[model samples]
Target: MNKIFLFISFALISITTQAQEIKWMSFNEAVKAQKKNKKPIFIDVYTAWCGPCKILDKKTFSNPETAKFINDNYNAVKFDAEGNEEIVFNKMTYKNPGYKPERKNSRNAMHEFTGFLKIQGYPSMVVINNKGQIQKTIVGFKTSEELKKEL
Candidate 1:
C-alpha cells in the first residue's frame, strides 16, 4: 500500500508540473529568463469567457510542435484582459480599481498591457524583444505551421 501510494503521488506531481511548462508565465520571470536564453517573450492576453481563447489553447497551444517552438524560443505570459490584477510596467502602475466584472466598458475598462499591445481580440499573441519592446501582436487562431513562421 505504501509503495502504491508513493507511486501515485509522484505521478500526480509529474502531471501538475508538466502542465505548468506549457502555460504562460508572468512578466518579471520572463524578463529574467530572456536575459539567459535571448529569445523573445510571447504574451497571450485573453478573457475568461472568450471562446477563441479556449480554441487556441487546445488547438494551437496543445500541439507538440507549438510546445517545442515556444519552449525553445519564447517565455509565454497569459494575461486576462478583463481581469483586475495590478500590473507594473516601466515604473508605472496599471490597475482598474473600478473594474466591474462582466460589464461592458466600465471604469476599469482595460489593462494597460492590452492597450499597449492593441489586443482587438481574445487569444491575441504579442511577441516582445529581449529588451522588452513590442515586436508584433498576432490576433486570432494560428495553426502550428502558421505560428512557426512568425517565430
Candidate 2:
C-alpha cells in the first residue's frame, strides 16, 4: 500500500509540474496573444547554426520555472533568425530570399528581423510591451531565475 501511494504521488507530481509550464508559441501567435491579453511579448530570436542558440533552447528555455513565468506574464515567441518563415512586422513584410543555409542549420533566411532587432549576437531575446515598445533586450543564454525576474 505504501509503494502504491508513492507511485501515485510521483505520477501526480509529474503531471503537476508539466502543467506549470507553458507551450512555446510561434511569433505570430505570440503577437496575437499580446493583442488579446494586453500582455508583454517575450521573443526569442535565434539562428539554427548558433551553438548558444541551441543551448538556450535546450537548457534555458526548457526550464519549468522560465516556462511558467513566461506563460503567466508574457506571450512567448520563438523565431529563427535564418529561417524561411515569411513574417510581417511593423507594417512591412520582410524577406531574404537569397540567404543560404549555413553550416548544419536546417534552412535559409526569408526574413529581415535580424537587422530590425539589431541582433549582433546569437540567442538574443527581446521583450516588448503591448503598445509595440521594446521593454528590454537580452542576449545569450539566461537561466530560468534570471529570465523570470525580467518577466
Quick one: best lDDT, which candidate?
A: 1
Give residue 16's lDDT in candidate 1 (0 to 100): 66
Error of 2 at 55 (Å): 1.6
List the RMSD of every prediction in angstroms: 3.8, 3.3
Any residue pairs clashing in model 2, and if so which? Answer: none
User: Backbone clashes per model, in order?
Assistant: 0, 0
| Candidate 2 displacement at residue 137 in angstroms | 0.8
lDDT of 2 by residue, 4-122 (tens): 99999999999988876666688777777777899888888887767878877777777877777778888888877877666676687766676765632665553586677777777
In order of appearance, the predictions have TM-scores of 0.77, 0.79
- Model 1 lowest lDDT segment of ten: 104-113
Tens-digit lDDT string for candidate 1 (81-107): 877767776677777665687573332
